[model samples]
Every structure is written in C-alpha cells, then in structure tokens.
Target: MIIEKLLFHTFIILAPVLIQTSLLEHHKWSKSPIFTGVLNGLATLTCLAFTYEFAGLYWDFRYVPLIIAMVYGGRKAGLIVLAFMLIGRTIMGGDILFHGLASAVIASLIPYYFSKGFWKMSPVKRVVAAQFIGLWPIAIIFLMLFVFHLPSQFLSELHSITFILQFGLVQVLGIGIAARLNEWMVEKKVMREEIIKSEKLNTLGELAASIAHEVRNPLTVVKGFLQLMKRQSKGEEDEYLAIILSELGRAEEIINDYLNFAKPQFEKVERVHIKEILSEVSILLNAYAVKECFFGEPPGG
Candidate 1:
C-alpha cells in the first residue's frame, strides 16, 4: 500500500508529460515537462487535502485518472486511481483523523462502479455513467458535512450550495466532451466498415447479373427443343414430361428469387395476418408437409 501511494504520486507528476507526449504530439503546449509534472503534483496534492478536509470536495477530482486510463489505456488506469486514492487518504492521515474521510470513501467508490459497468455501456452512455457516478455521491457527503457544522463567516450555506451546483455542471460538461470524442471514434470505424462492405456487394451484383444473362439463353433454347419434341410425338409421350416442364418453371422462379436477392428492393408494408399466410403456404406444400405446426395441445390429446 505504501509503495502504491508512492507510485500514484509519481504518476501524477509524470502523467501530464506522458499524456502530452503520447496524445498531444501534434498540439502545442507552452509548458515544460518538469514544470508540468511539479504543477500537477502540487495541484493534485492540494485537491486531495481539500477533499480530505471537506466532505464532498472529492467530487471535483474523482474521475480524472479513471477516465484518462479507461479511455486511453484500460484496467491498469484503475490501479492508478486506487493508488492515488489511498495515498491521498494516507497523507491526510486517513478518514478517521480528518473527520470527513468516511464520507470521502463513499464518494470515491463511485468511479469503481462505473468501471464495473464499463463493458455494458455505449461510448456516450459510458461518459454519462462516469459523470453521474463521480458526482452523485457528493450530495451524500455534502449533507454529512453540512449538517455537522454551521456555516462560518467566510463559508455560508448559500455559498456551499452554489459551489456544489457549479461543481456538478462542470463535471457534466467535461465528461460530455470526452464521451463525444469516444463516440466519434466509434462512428468513424462503423463508416469505414460500411464502405468496404458496399464495395464488395456492388462487385458481386455485377458478376451475378453477367452470369444470369449467359445461362438464361441456353435454358430458353433447351425449352424450345423440348416443346418441339412434344408436338411431334405420335404415341403418348413420357408421363413425366409435364412434371419436367413444371420443375423447369420452378427452377426459373428460383433464379428470379436469386436475382432479386442480389438487387435491393423495398416493400410497402400493410397489416396482414401472419398465421393466415403460414396456412396458405402449408396448403401449397401439402404433399411435402411432414409435421404440423401447433399452437397448443395435439388434436387427439
């Protein structure tokens, strides 16, 4: 735990440098690495103290690492968050000494809940979940802190209320932006896949049309000869000649079905009885029907 806290502090010091180098390479920054690291460390430590001293101030800082790690990295980022949390608590001498640590623990656990449900969420929804999880527990902490002490000269009830509201608004906006970025990436990937698939389908449709045209001419010639043979026969022709022609017609219908499948078609839907359609199909296939479809008990039963 002690080692983890040290690593958390180290991450806070270096995270900006790591982020700027890895993600912000194309973007310009006026800050230097050493300066940025020191500033981030100081600022993070200050916020940790404030959150420890005040009940709900932790709301301002909860999801920073979680969002960064989850978006850019993965579960390892959660460890960074947990490490920072423990370090922040230990530095302030734990919640017991601070009088508000108990509240902070509940407040801090919100992000973990978000992480647990991360896989189930869409990009936009994941951001919303992180935002809500980060801020909702702050209300409980605020109530705990507020009720314990009366407002002093500098801190009034109105001031605390305004701060809470503003804090929440900022959180929502930040998470919203991050979530939008994630969703944009997802949309881009989907569009790329659709374009590739459309190209492949277009090529296939052209090839099928060419093949169908070539086959249809030979099929027609064969049908013509069969018809001539029927007309010239004196004795009763083969009994199955009619069946052969019928099967040929069915084959042509199947080819038509395939052609239609290759080309897109739109249907205008009207309300109709699905059960009635099924019964009609069954009637047409009576000779081939092997089993009856039942809604309930069998007729004999």
Candidate 2:
C-alpha cells in the first residue's frame, strides 16, 4: 500500500514531462524558458495538491520540479517555479509552514545559483548534479527537524529510518528521470531541425539546377550566333567578337557552378596576364560608355 502511494505521487510529479514528450512535435513553446518555468511550476503545484501524509505532515517531491526548472530553464525559470512553490505552501497552511518556506528558500539557492553550468554537463553528470542539488532541500528539512527537537518517539514512530532513506532515494530517482527526459526531448528537437534544414538546402539545390539549365540553353544559342559572327568579321571587329566570346565562356562557367551544386569541377589552371584582362575590360567599357553614355569617366580612368 505504501509503495503504491509512492508510485502514484511519482506519477503526479512526472506527469507534465511525460505529456510534453508526447506533444514534442506539436508544442510551440514547449522548450522556452517561460514555458519550462510554467510546466515545472505546474508539476510542483500538482505534487503539492496530491501530497501524502508522512511524519505527521504532508510530503511530496515538489522540489524536484523546482530543480528541473532551474536546470533546463535557468535562473528566471527557477524563480518562477520557486514563486509557485512558495504560493502553494502559503495556501496549504499545513504543519511546519514556516519551516517549509525556509527549507524551500535555502534549498532553491543551490540549483538557481549553479544552473548556468548544468547544460555543459554530460547526461550522467546532469542526473548526478540534479540529484546532488535535490539533497540540499532535504538536508534543510532534516536540519529543521533537529532544530525543532521533536520527541524521539515521534521521529522513530512516524518517520522510521528505513522510510526516511526511501524518501531520499525516491527524490533522487525523481530528479534523474526529469533531467533524462529533458535531454531526450532536446535530442529529438535538434534532429527535427536538422531534417528541416537539409530539406530546405535540397530544395534550393533543385531550384538552382532547374534555373541554370534553362539559362544555359539560351546562352548556348547566343554563343553559336557569336561564333558565326566571329568567322565573318574582320580585323578589330574580330578582336571585339573574341572578347565577347571569352565573356560568354565565363558566363557558362558560372552556370556550371550552379548546375553542379553537389560536387564542383575545377577548370584547368592557366596563367592569366593582368595586361590582357585590363585591355579586355577597357575595350568593353569604352564601347559601353560610348554606346550607352552612362559613365562620366569610364573604368580604370
């Protein structure tokens, strides 16, 4: 019977995380800081709501939710969850209310202060870190236990040594499950984003190939006409035609770059003289400037 209740409470504690995983693909704010804070705060509230009687007071793994909010959502989220925790405690007005508040304040500081480093840790280290931080609140509770100096019989009878140990172990297990679930959720989200990005790149590649092939066909027709003109032209006109053909060839190379998106083919390395390039550009610019009258001085003036 006792084991069954503990399992039930554990389910209540983990209910939010389990639900978030089920809606992993659908939720928009599932992993946001404010959302994380709200979810964990809801978990704390649920734990508080369904608390079981132990040691003549209500008991729950509410702090595990608070720690989780801190670990994943950082300090802002931790404070949000902490506020919910304090509110719940105030509303309940149960045994040792002030002690509960004090324990919460003291316990929460550990995780809230150190959450920045939590993401840098490995999964195993994260679980261990959460477990270690979870122990602080429990330790605070124990310290309160000693400070209040409850009767020896009350301690021995209501909260036996074995049960106390089991409580600590259960909190440890609870935090481990929370942190692990978060890690799993993050991995799934990352994989989905990668798939989306790959698909977009593939779409862009296909578009480039289609457009390049279409443009290359028109360029081929133009090149054929230019070659015909090159054969018929004389002297200076022939030189100008050659320059046009050279520029047409460079345009084809650019189209090839677009067509072969997956793998690029490099052309043979040929030594190019600066004088020939400058002369070609100057002649082309001079013709364009005379024809269009767009340039006031022309290139390389």
Candidate 3:
C-alpha cells in the first residue's frame, strides 16, 4: 500500500509539469501561446515542490493539481496535462487499470463543461454540473466493491466512502476554479469583438459617404431613362410600365441604403451563399452586357 500510494502521488504531481512541457514544446495551446509556456514551467516547478512533502498522499490527491491546471489554464490545456499525468502514472507502475482509468475518464469529463458550445453558460454552473455528473463513477466503484465482497488485502474499505466524498469535493473545487478561468477568457473575447466592430463601423461611415456621392449620377440617369421609356411606350404595354416602376423602386431603395450605410445600425447576421448573391447581381445587370469582348480577349477564354 505504501509503495502504491507513493507511486500514485508522485505520478500525479509530475503529470501537470510533463503535460505543460508537451503543450509548450509542441505549441498546442494557441489562444495564449506564451501563457501556456510560462504557466507550464511554473506549474511543473510548483508541483515538484509539493511532491517532496506530500508524495505519500499524491495518488488520492492527484486530482487537485489536475483541476488546477484545467481551471487556471483551460479545458484543452487541462486535457493535455491530464493525458501526460495518466501516461506518467502508468509508466511509474501505479494505478494502471482501474484507478488510472477512473482518473483519466473523470479528467476527460471535466472539459465538456467549458466546451465552445457551452461558452455562453456561466463557468460556475458548468463546474457544478460536471462535478455532479463525474461523481457517478465513485458510486459505481462503491457498489462494485460491496457486491463482490473483494478480499481485504486488495480492496479493503479503508474509509472508502469518505475518501470518495473527499475526492468529489476536491474535484468540485478544482472545476470551479477552472470555470472562472473560462469566464475570464470569454469576457476578453467579447471585448475584442466590440473593438473590431467599432473600427469597422467607422470605416463603413467613410465608405458610405463616398458611395452616396458616386451613386447619385447613376441613379439620376436611371430615372431619366425610365421616364423616356415610359413616354415612348404605348399606354397598353402594362409590362413596360411594370419594368419602369420596378427600376424606379430600386433607385429609391438605393437612396435609403445610402442613408442606412451612413449611420449604420447592427444588421441581422445570417448565413448567405456568396454564389447566389453573385447570380442575383448578374441578373440585375444583364441589360448592360455588350456583344463585343473587352481587351481583345479570345471568345470563351
């Protein structure tokens, strides 16, 4: 038990450091690349310090550092760290099948709380929910022990329920911290978007003024041509009148568009097909096409 316990704790303590190295060395965490590097270096050293004093208690306590890495860093960072730790633990001949598996599975479950889809949710709520969900394995472990009545030498109770409860509590705390980190990251991203949008709006204002001035000449010509076409057409040609009216309506719409662009407001954002928009523009301008090719280009080139 002492050897197993020593092996577990040492493995857990070094897990974060090794994982951090992996991330930094491999350049995996792109959101804050430098942050991952520095943090990994610092965390590895910190865990090394903790291992000297608490080496015997490491196995049961490994989750604490795992949770810390996840919270202080992010879910992706946490997973990388956890993977390193699991591999390290397995290599050290500690908790390879059951305990190791449990820890890895539990660690994997932590990230779902702060996944991209869950970004809108509060981190605290996500952590609480994850803790609740993650505790099921502990329950299952206990039931298995009870049903099988395992040999005392190998699977003694050893304050089993109490230890499991403690493990759950530690995990909950770790997850809570991680969620806060995610929230901070989200707020920063929102602020960045606002800045970008403000700059875009300013640029749009200048462009709108230029567009309005340039479009005035075309609009006037269009109105004049519509008036001439209407006068030339016989009164019975309803289709010609309809075409002229639509052209005039489009001119009016362009005037409104200039006003809107000048003092732009937030527009509804939705998915649009670029090809469809291009097709619409082509159909609108079909009347302007000439039979002669420009620049003396070969036909169909």
Best by lDDT: 2
Q: Pick the candidate with the highest TM-score.
A: 2
Minimal lDDT window, size 10, model 2: 151-160
Ranking by lDDT: 2, 1, 3
Give the per-residue lDDT digits (tens) of candidate 3, residues 1-301.
4344444444544444444444433343534534542444344334434442221223244444444445445665556656555554555553324554564566556443544444354657655654554454445444544444544633455665445555556545544444444455556667878999999988878887778767876777887776777778876775877777787778768777777657646578788999999999999776556433344568777
In the predicted model 3, the residue pairs found to clash are 9-58, 9-59, 71-178
> What's the TM-score of each model vs. the native?
0.49, 0.75, 0.47
TM-score of 3: 0.47
Which whole-number lDDT from 0 to 100 does residue 73 have in model 1? 34
The RMSD of every model to the true structure, in order and in angstroms, is 20.2, 16.8, 16.6
- In model 2, pairs of residues that clash are none
lDDT of every model, 2 decimals: 0.54, 0.81, 0.53
For lDDT, candidate 1 versus 2, the one ahead is 2
